[model samples]
Target: MKKFHRDASTLVLTLISVLLLTVSALICLKALGPHGEPMPSVTDWISAVGQAVGALLTGGALIYAARTYSKQRQDRHEELEQKRQEQAGKIIVRVKHGLPDDRTSVSLTNPTNLPIFKMNLYTIDDDGQVIEGQPLSEEVVVGDYPGHAYTQRYRVHSAYAVFTDSGGVAWIRTSKGTLFE
Candidate 1:
């Protein structure tokens, strides 16, 4: 689709160039008429109308090119933002050894430099079932710098854990590895 738009814009630019050249040639011919005599009034008027039409066509083509360029820039920006989000979503949590009742807490370190706000935690049972956890007494705010970790002690037991950030991006971790969604 991008290639198609580029090709179409190129074609329009070429047509505009041709139209301009034609109008210029007509004006030159009128200025250097045969035997120094200008063409009839009717022919001069027709040429003037043609020049006006050519100018309008060139203006339209330029507007189209500007719009196409703007759209392409916007699309590129959106694509970059999506990729940044995917990278930002890679928050990892390491659960310390011990059972949920052992006073051990799950620790999350934000490797990213951007702070994470309003983060939430959930759990997965041995049966691969998700159990929604209760909200923290205070909102979870994780700083972006490395070595910045947040740990929460669980009141209940679960085999696996899931962490979600303010952006609604979630990551699941177990003994196996981390899974992102």
Candidate 2:
């Protein structure tokens, strides 16, 4: 739809340009002489027309360049925004060691417009044993809101998280790397 509108506008501009050029040429011919009495030279008429249209051509080129630059900037901005949203939606797991107790946190951020549902997290031991973990709540819908988090207080060790979204797609994440759905 937008492309159609842009093409239509370009066609209209081309037609207007042609009309303006024709009118200017006719005016130049009339100025030379109506009955061909003491008519100006052909070179003189051509020079006059070129001088008249020079400023209009310059202005049109400038306008086209400005529009192209604006469009490129807008496209770049939209691409960056998409990347930021993807980065924001990833599952982040962190472990904080304190004097009294070490706490591990599992969080899934939803930067998209759709709300996420039924997210769960799990803990992994040094022996690669999966232990039952907990979430801030069961079946929480998270979106632009603060969302939900699961935290456990234990000695800081190797751990990861697992969850399934409303789409029934499972996701796994660890502190080192390899976090995806």
Candidate 3:
């Protein structure tokens, strides 16, 4: 909307400038002649002024088009970045309750085709403090397919996972479904 307003103002200003120039040229021609008769070389002067105004309008149009294209390209780039960030968030961490005989488990799943590196899953309390689990010593790559699971004996309040995406961007995803870089 702001871009629209700016473009509109620019067009209005250009038109006003052209109108003033044309009126000024007509006034000059009138003042140089007697009894409102067009002076000698009047047609030549008008022709020159017309060419200058045409060039000015053409230049303004080209500049406006270039700026509009640049803005559209930038908007597309930002949209793609946002989509990438959302895809990175698809790395899921969940605490699963198993059968009566089975132990509680924490699983890290990477649904995306891209592999995530240095994945670390943690069980956190209500206060967001890490209550259980340790960071993996080696960088683990979690790919698409069956997820990696850990048998967690302790009851979990919540869970979160930290990992680097295929694009080398780091992200943190909570069990509550919040994701951020």
What lDDT would each prediction earn against the true structure? Answer: 0.53, 0.54, 0.66
Ranking by TM-score: 3, 1, 2
TM-score-best of 1 and 2 = 1
Worst 10 residues of 1 by lDDT: 144-153
Q: Estimate the overall C-alpha local distance difference test score of candidate 2.
A: 0.54
For each candidate, how many residue pairs have backbone atoms clashing (under 3 Å)?
0, 0, 0
Q: Which candidate do you rate higher for lDDT, 1 or 2?
A: 2
TM-score against native, each model: 0.43, 0.38, 0.66
RMSD of each: 8.7, 8.2, 6.2
lDDT, candidate 3, equals 0.66
Rank order by lDDT, top first? 3, 2, 1
Model 3: lDDT of residue 121: 72
Off by over 4 Å in 2: 41-47, 50-52, 55-108, 111-181
Better of 2 and 3 by lDDT: 3
lDDT: the better of candidates 1 and 3:
3
- Those runs of model 1 whose alpha carbons end farther than 4 Å from true positions after fitting are 1-46, 49-53, 76-80, 83-87, 94-105, 129-138, 143-181
